[model samples]
Target: MEIKFGDAKYYAYTGTHDPASDLESVVFVHGAAMDHTVWAHQSRYFAYHGYNVFAVDLPAHQFSRGELLLSIERMAAWLNQVIDQTVGTAFHIVGHSMGALIALEAAANFNHPDAGLNSLSLIGFSYPMSVTPQLMDAAQHNPSEAYSMMTQWSHASAIGGEPVPGFWSAGMQLSMMENSTAGSVHTDLIACDNYAGGEAAFVKVTCPILFLSGMRDKMAPAKLAQAEADKNNNAAIVLLPDCGHSIMSESPDGVLNELKRFIGARK
Candidate 1:
């Protein structure tokens, strides 16, 4: 599923369309180092509900061809082009982790005229990028410790109550540290932690925003997400009772159910 665009190549997978009704389109964006496979659960669930689904591999990771620019701006630009090509005007954008930043860029930074998106649903994200210095320092100096913390924190006993299965641990580990030139993985962590635009660009976003968070999301922190969601005139914040950073994996059914209702309410 390679599509040549300018000098870059993007990998895309289309899930089965929803049978309930005709949907405009749905694009699922994955975070850093992760591929479209990350959305396997979400895509299948949503597509079955009667909507077109598109899961894409982000730049520098997986099936995509290009040196990792690692810039959210470039990420949005690439997504805009893809949308215009396939659906002419494209559709709603759903993003997680690093992909959330790209969605923000699409709604705020880039503002593609052909995006044709009516809404945005951002899960596991917080505005103003509160990726504190403590987290950043830990990620760079002690990646293993950081990884362990992620695993431990992902449990229901941690921040939120939802428990992440050990099944995803291997995938997450490999994605973060698989291929690299010595310190590239650490470098990626730094870039992600120090991502820009904070809250200014986000506040200007006019589209309806749906913010998802775990009651105790170690990364985004529930309180922070709620406050960010409050700034938007058309935003709704949902705290998955006992979820962690990876809300999709921690509570796939919860997310899908909420999305089903969200989609129903929109039209």
Candidate 2:
């Protein structure tokens, strides 16, 4: 689906399901240099199972058109605007990696009392997600190398252990990053590296939260995510064994089942 926010057009994959007022809504936000397609496995399931899904492509990424929102705060604010215009009702938000930080900030500062935030699910996330200098440099000057490094590090095994039979998880991830608009990886990495408000935001969020981490994640370690979840009264953490930062690909069923339990319980 397409909507205009100011002069720029924003795009979201709705699993080919048209939203209705009676249906509950859920929005899925992707990690850096990724798009709505990352949520392909989960979004369609939710959409067909009575929820309205908005798997969004952030501005300047994939199908969305606009200058990149250069910081987590700006991305969160823009996300809120998108939510207000699209869902405009009680909803759940699911975010991964860099998108998780955006979801954290948005849920913390959520001002829509009428359109409540039912729940938040953060996957493969960490507070103050630091980007390595080597990765940042590669993203800026040698994007292919950056993609290679990220793809290698994102999964538990570099060879083949994808949840989907015969599907090349690492290849897909690399292709997605390679296809991103120029400078988007560096822009996203800068946003993640510079953001410092996650701890504060976690304290402010009142709704139930799910911290879904991968046990073998080298990018944002599960320990960091657990530490943040520890501070929240209404939060739970689930660690997926033998998985890495790209939990959605390596453990799609695990991710889906946990989300169903978390979001379905609230409903």
Candidate 3:
């Protein structure tokens, strides 16, 4: 479904039901060079099981319009707009990779008179998400090469675990990145690299946080994720064995179960 946030129209994957009438809403944010479909498995699950799901496509990504926000701060602002325009109040937030950083910023810094962030789930996240120079250069001059590097580093093995039979996870992710607007990958990489507010932002978070990491994650390893989790006294860290950075696709059931448990306890 498309909703108007200022002049920009945002696309959200609402699955079989709309969130217009639901009191409980969950917003899912995708990583850099990715779209709402990354939460396909979990969004559908929540939408039909008594919760409103807003799996959003970030600006200049897939079906969403407007130029890409180049910083985590701006992305958090966009997230606040999304919540205000849609649910209009408190809601649960889930984010992955770069999206996780955005969620953290939004939870810590964003303020809305009519709404508030209820809880946060950060999956495959890191504090100082430093992007390698080679990846940044590739994103600027050759996006295809950047996509290749991302695909390789985003999974546990060279051949990634698929969400379904005959559907290759790494290939699907590559296609999604390839479809992104020109220079978007570069902008996203720079955004993650330049973000310096993570530790500070995390310290200010008032809600319960769930930190989910993949033990085999090469991009954001379990140790790095645990370091971030350690700062939050209210955070519960779960490490999925054999999973990679793409936790939703690589270990959909595990991720969904953890989400169910976390959101259930809060609700």
Candidate 4:
């Protein structure tokens, strides 16, 4: 169903839970260039288990209101509003790719006074340190070049032990291109490029986090992600063999298993 929050409508698969209960909701955030469709399997699975699921499309992305503003903080702030309106209060955050960055930002700023949060899961992402200045500049000057750079990083292999076509995922890439203004990428590359606290912030993430990565991931590239993991002490980094960067689509089973463990363990 759709929850009208702020200026946009958030698409979620929420379960029946008392609105007054401190019972938290699960909000799934999608990565850059992708919409809420990627989490179709996960949202359906979670809703089956009585968990309130809110799989929302971020502002500036398709199926959502507002212009495509590339600021991560702006997206996070809008997301915060969604949280307040949809299921006021406690929540569990699950972010993939760029959405993982949003989860981090939300966890950093979350101050649910009524009660504490449930847990957080970061999937299909490593760290932002992988992006180089040249890539950042390319995305700003010529988005096609940036799009190419992103294409180069996308993991195209399938989790079902089959090879998936690159064109299958081209729609997401195309969305990025169409949403972008100024004839360049929509977002400010500098935000990702200038993400400070590279090492220390991982420590600040006191919540239990699950870092899902593909063995063949090119974007967060497994090696660089490992380097970043050297900094996160409370995180569990799982590597999927023969898989690419697209963990949700590649290994729905693996993703489901990890999520079940993460959510089940809380009880």
Best-matching candidate per TM-score: 2
* lDDT-better candidate, 2 vs 3: 2
Model 3, span 1-267: residue lDDT tens = 897867888888888675654367898999999999999889899888878888999898999998889899999998877777776346889999999999999888756666666789999998799998998999999999999999988887666356578878888889999888888999999999999998788889999999999998988888988987787798989999987898888899999999999987887
RMSD of each: 4.0, 1.0, 1.6, 4.0
* Model 2 regions lying over 4 Å from their true place: none
Model 3 poorest 10 in a row by lDDT: 15-24
Show pairs that collide, candidate 3: none
**Candidate number that wins on lDDT, 1 or 4:** 1
Residue 222, candidate 4: Cα error in Å is 2.5
Candidate 4 TM-score to native: 0.78
For lDDT, candidate 3 versus 4, the one ahead is 3
**Which candidate leads in lDDT?**
2
Q: What C-alpha lDDT values do all the predictions have?
A: 0.66, 0.91, 0.87, 0.65
Show how many residue pairs clash in every candidate, following the order shown: 9, 0, 0, 1
Prediction 1 global C-alpha lDDT: 0.66
C-alpha lDDT of residue 165 in model 1 = 42
Can you tell me which runs of candidate 4 are displaced by over 4 Å? Answer: 1-24, 88-90, 113-115, 130-149, 156-185, 188-190, 197-200
lDDT agreement of model 4 with the native: 0.65
**Each prediction's TM-score versus the true structure:** 0.80, 0.98, 0.95, 0.78
45 Cα displacement, candidate 3 (Å): 0.3
Q: lDDT by residue for model 4 over 1-267, one digit each (tens)?
A: 566764655554454433435345678898765677778778778766756678877665556656665556666676766776655345778888777777777776666555455677877666663467777777767677776676556655322344345434444545554464442242645545555543454666677777777888877677665666666676667787766767776667777788888766763
